[model samples]
Target: MIEFRNVYAGYGGGDVLQGLDLKVEDGSITCIVGPNGAGKSTVLRVLSGLIHPRVGEVRLGGAAIHDKSPAAVLAAGIAQVPQHNALFGNLTVHDNMLLGGYILRRNRRAVRRRVDELAEIFPTVAERAHEKALNLSGGQRRIVEFARALMTGPSVLVLDEPTLGLDPKTCQAVFETTKKINSLGTTILMVEQNVRFGLKLASHGVVMERGRALLAEPADDLLRRPDMGAMFFGHGIEDPTAAPQIATASTDSSGA
Candidate 1:
């Protein structure tokens, strides 16, 4: 499990995440949903070691990992797909994935073997190995990022607003892709702005406001509860319109 025990982290002066105490279970998808500037991405950054907590502990399976280097975080089996695409638009897809293996023995033989194995799991990476990353669509680019993150063989995958900027069809596609990844056994922790989409894709749900956690529960329960709706979507708090239309999203993978 990955946890934040009283985590307090921020930018130059002010703390965005204040006293965050949370946990993500192994092999489960946990979604953190909140409004703008609620420090959703900040939580992922701290977990991945891009930002260290100003105070308190960040632990993985009970060992303190706060303030470790990004390389150290990767070695500890954590990989992050940032809010942005985070791919090298200038490089070929194959090279971008190879970079994820930076902490590994980068001898050509080892890199090639790992790449081939990942390509089997994520066919797009293999099919477009020679193509520049810029040529892919938003959903396809997100898949490439997932493929790249897998090169590290991380135990935990952290993604930030992964479906942002996509059309409804694309959003559904991305959610399905996340399910397929979880089935492969990596634990997932993410911040998603698509409130309904986020909760539906996850087994566990975390709600935050003003940089503090407000609620954590089984995702389907969160969907059925009135307060959970109020917290995520504000007072109007409308449930998914025509949910029958969007119900095709697979929540079967969500085993709380």
Candidate 2:
């Protein structure tokens, strides 16, 4: 489990995540959704040790991990897929996967074995193992990142915008891959722009606004409450019966 207590962090001038308190339960998928620039990505950065929290504390399981280095955080069993496809376009898919194992250089044979195992689960990576990463589609690239993240054998996975620019079909593909990763016992902490799709699969749902948690509700109950759209999206959608468009949007987003 991951816990944040009055956690505050930002870059340069100000705090984007202001006194944020969050909990990611063990063996569950927690999805954070909110408007653009609501400090969604900042949470991932703080936890991944990419950005240091100015105040408060962050803990992985029971240990205080605030202000740790990125490598140190990964060594503590955390892997993060940043918002954009942070891949080297010129490198072959296999090489990209190898880069994730720098922390495991001593276990070369084990890394090779794990890469093979992951390729079996994600055929796209296997089929294009020798191809340049730039050639794959956005969705396929996302899965490769997932495979690469697992090379370190981390128990916690932090994902920032797993699906952003893909078509509907491709989004479905990425979603399925996320499910497979979580099934392997890697706890998932994700920030998504597309609310309904991600939340539907989430065991826990968090709503953030202006760098603060507006609400935390079970995914199912949140979806059924029409006020969710109005509160989060700034639309006056109070009742499902009165608004078919809102109903369809909410229902479709819930992955139903």
Candidate 3:
């Protein structure tokens, strides 16, 4: 399980995540939803080791990893796929997958074997093996990103808005692939913009406001809550323009 206890973190300007607490069970798809500046993605960054918390503890399976480097986190079996493309546009799809396992450079044979295994699971990887990532559609590129993240055979996969810019059909495809990945035994922690869709796919749900987790429960229960839409998106049937109730001072309303 991944747990955060009273975590506090932010960019140089100020704190974004303030006294946040969360838990992600092993072998489950936990989806986090919130308004624009609720520190949703910031939570993922902390888990992935891109940033460290100023105060609090981040533990995976009861072990502290709060101060580990990004590479260290990856080696510890957490792979993160950012909101934007992290792929090398000019590189072949196959090369990108190989790069995901760069830490395993000494074992060329194992890397190749893992690539082949993932290609079988994600047919798009094999189909676009020789193509440049830039040439694929948004949906295809996202699939390749997932395929690449799995190259390291991580125990946990962190995804930030996996279906952000895809067409309806492609969006469904991506979610389906995510489920397939989970079936293969990797825990998934994701932040999503489409609240309803994300909750439907998740086994657990987390609702955040201004860096603090206000709700945590089974996804079905959270989806059934009458105030869910209002709580996360700052809009309900009656108050369409109501501002999201923030719990902190910083208002960097970009990602997370």
Candidate 4:
């Protein structure tokens, strides 16, 4: 399980996460939903070690990870796919995937084996192995990103708006792939803008406001609550449309 206890994190300006506490069960898909600037992405940043919390404890199966560096975090079994494009446009899809296992470069055979395994899992990787990443469509790129992140064989996958900007069909495809990943035994922690769809896809759901989680419960229970829509958007959930306002923090920066 993953746990965040009283996490207080932010950029140089001010705190974005105010004593935030959240828990994700092992092998479960947890979707986080909230209004813009609610620190949803910031939560991911802290988890990925892009920024360390000023006060808190982040643990993975009871091991402390709050103060680890990004590399250490990755080594500790957490891999993240950012909201923005992270592909090397000029590189072949195969080459981009190889980079995902850069830390294991010394073990050439292992990295190649992992790549081959991922290609079999994500069809886009198999079909466009030699093609440049820049040439693939948005949905295809997202699939490749998922495959790449899995190259490290992480136990936990953190996704930030995996379907951001894609059409409805593409979003469905991404969600399906997410389900497939979770079924394969990787615990998933995701932040999605489509509230209804996200809730439906996840086993657990969290509602955040003012940088703190206001509600955390089973997804179905949250969906069944009559006041969910009003509390989250001041309206019904019929037309859920709100994007996160903050920039995602990159591995090299704290300016999320």
Candidate 5:
């Protein structure tokens, strides 16, 4: 399990996560959704050790990791696929996958074995093994990115907007791949822009506003709420029939 207890963090300017608290259960797919600048990506950054929380603690399986370095976090079994393209354009897809296991380069045999295993799982990796990353289509590249992230055999996979900007068919492909990955026993923690699709794909859902988690519950229940649109748009819920499980927050919005 992953837990963030009163986490407060941000870039150099100001706090993006304001006294935030969240929890991700083990072996579950937890999807977080919110409007722009709700600090969605920032949560993934804190988890990946790209930024350390100024206050509070982040724990993975009960081990505190808020202060750990990026490498340490990766070694501790958490891997992230960022929102933007991260592949080296000039490098071959195979080379990129090799780089994902750079820390284990000393054991060339094991790393190579892992790559071969992933290539079997992601056929695009095998079909375009020698092709430069720049040569693959957007969808193919994203698949390679997913395969590369698995090189470390992480217990948890963090994805930020995995299907952003893709065609509808590609979006479905990506979501299918996400499900396949989850079936392989890795816990998934993701931030997605497509609310309905994301909620449908997840076992649990979290709603965020102004850097705070406003609601956390089973994804189906959240999806069924009639005031979902109101929540995302910052309009107070007028539905007296709405679930009482939702926690209300101040109307003011800030941070990214």
Candidate 6:
């Protein structure tokens, strides 16, 4: 399980995450939804050790890891795929995957074995093993990214907007791949802009506004709640067409 207790963090200007208190149950797919600037990506950054909390606790499976280094966080069985594609476009797919396990280079045999296993799970990895990452389509690239993140066989996977620029069909495929990964026993925590699809895919849904989690519940329940829609889409407010405005926070128009 991953838990955050009264956590606070931010870049130089100000705190983006403000007193966040949340828990992700073990072996579950938890999806976080919020408008841009709500600190959704920041939450993942904190988890991956890209950003450290200024205050409070972050625990993974009961171990304290708030301010640990990125390597330390990965060693604790957490892997993250950032919002942008981290692939080496000029490198072959196989090489890109190998880079993900660079720390395990000393055990070359183990890395190869793991790569083979992942290839079995993600056929695209095998199909494009010899091809440069730049040659693959958007959906295929996302699949390769997913495969790379799993090279370490992490217990927790943090994905930030995995399907950000894909078509509808490809987006669904990516979601299916996410479910496949979760089914294989890795816990997943994701931040997504596609609200309806994300909520439907997740076991648990979290709604954040201005750096705080305002609502957390079963995905189905949250989807059924009228107020949840109102909160996220700026519905029933002064201007319905305006971008979402968190009622508790000052109004702003930003894309999720």
Best by TM-score: 5
TM-scores, all candidates, are 0.87, 0.88, 0.90, 0.89, 0.93, 0.90
CA lDDT of each prediction against the hidden true structure: 0.81, 0.81, 0.84, 0.84, 0.86, 0.84
Per-residue lDDT for 94-122 in model 3, tens only? 99988887764538888888999999999
Candidate 3 regions exceeding 4 Å error are: 233-256
Tens-digit per-residue lDDT, 1-256, candidate 1: 8778777899997899878778788899999988777788888888878898988888899898997988898888998888666899989999998887764656777777888998998788899998999998887788889888888788999888898888898888788889999999999999998888999999988777777766667888767765555655454234555233223222321111
Residue 52, model 4: lDDT of 95
Q: How close is candidate 4 to the true structure, as a TM-score?
A: 0.89
How close to the true structure is residue 155 of candidate 1, measured as C-alpha lDDT? 91
Give the 10-residue window scoring lowest on summed lDDT in candidate 2.
247-256
Instruction: Report the C-alpha displacement of residue 120, candidate 2, in angstroms.
Output: 1.8
**Candidate 3 backbone overlaps, count:** 0
List candidate 6 stretches off by more than 4 Å: 234-256
**lDDT score for candidate 5 against the true structure:** 0.86
Off by over 4 Å in 4: 234-256
Candidate 1 global lDDT? 0.81
Which digits, one per residue and each the tens of the lDDT, describe model 2 over residues 1-256? 7888787788896999888777788888989987776788898988988898998888998998887999889999999888776888999999898887765574777777888899999998799999999998888898898889898999999888888788899889988999999998989989988889879878878777667665666777667765777656644335646454433332212211
Candidate 1: misplaced stretches above 4 Å? Answer: 233-256
Q: What is the number of backbone collisions in each predicted candidate, taken in the order shown?
A: 0, 1, 0, 0, 0, 0
Worst 10 residues of 5 by lDDT: 247-256
